[model samples]
Target: MPRKRTPDAHDRILDAAGGLFDRYGVHAVGMQQIIDDLGCGKQLLYREFASKDKLVVAYLERCTQDWDRTFARALAAAATPEEQLVEVVRAVQTMVPGTRGCSLRNTHAEFPDPEHPAHQVSLEHFKAVREQLRELARRTSAADPDRLGDRIMLIIDGVYASGATLGATGTAEEAVALARDVIRIETSLPVAESEIPADVR
Candidate 1:
């Protein structure tokens, strides 16, 4: 009879892989590293994940779920589109750390072939994120939807390229300030048409 596998093998492998990928990127990590970190035999790891590509897809999916929850919660905090936009920026503000870069962007740069299993999964995750930003742009009254959407995407790319080494947390804050300015410049505060309604005085 085959020996029973450790119950925590799945999570431990993912945790080890996530730390390695987030810190050094997926390509930099190897099966040896995973096996060493997991302290498990090769067969056990294979039984759980099958392949590195499949495991990578799982990790990216976890990131996506986490981000979606954050965005949804922030959006739910406000009643108006403009307010929701600010909250969205605030949501992004919380995502930065000192070492690891954005997981999705890192994967995109590391995976050379678009058809690579992990690469395809990352692409889908990216599309979903971009679509979310576009929807945020539509909700934000201060900037034109398409243009602001493009600019936000650009800023995000810049943030990833900046990396922790360049102090990207400051970049996130600066981006928020810039976004507020963009909104202010494009949108005027709603004003009464120089006369009060008789019913409201």
Candidate 2:
């Protein structure tokens, strides 16, 4: 009889795939690369994930979960809706340093076909994040929450885009300040400079 597989086999495969996917790209990393990275046989990987496409989908799903958790943790200390909106920027700023770029954006870029499962996962993740931003904008009494959310999303996209080339640290700092300014303006709050770093002021 065949021996039983380890309970963590699936998770281990995901872990290896996630690292490779993030570092290189979904399309760039192959099943053999993952197997080599994990020092496991192809059979074990195939047992956990039936195909490369399925593995990519699983990797993206895990990334989405991680992003949600990180954003939630970053927003936990925010006391107001405006602050919560700003926290979204802060969350990205905090997380971008460790990442090469936005994983969702990268996935979307790599898999431009809308019908692709990985692309769909990326789209859903983006929509969910935007909805979260819109909810916060609504709570903040913005004149137009959807518009405000869209604007903030644009700023975020710019930040991520720049982060891939122009150094994440500076870009992230500027992006957070810009986001805070937008939130304040939309809410008719005073143009407070408290959140702006002294160097950037």
Best by TM-score: 2
The global Cα lDDT (0 to 1) of model 2 is 0.82
Q: Which stretches of candidate 2 lie over 4 Å from their true place?
A: 1-7, 97-99, 193-201
The CA lDDT of each predicted structure is 0.73, 0.82
Q: Each candidate: RMSD to true structure?
A: 6.4, 3.0
Q: What lDDT does candidate 1 reach at residue 128?
A: 83
lDDT of 2 by residue, 175-199 (tens): 8888877887887887657756789
Which pairs clash (backbone N, Cα, C closer than 3 Å) in model 2?
A: none
TM-scores, one per candidate: 0.81, 0.89
Per-prediction backbone clash count: 0, 0
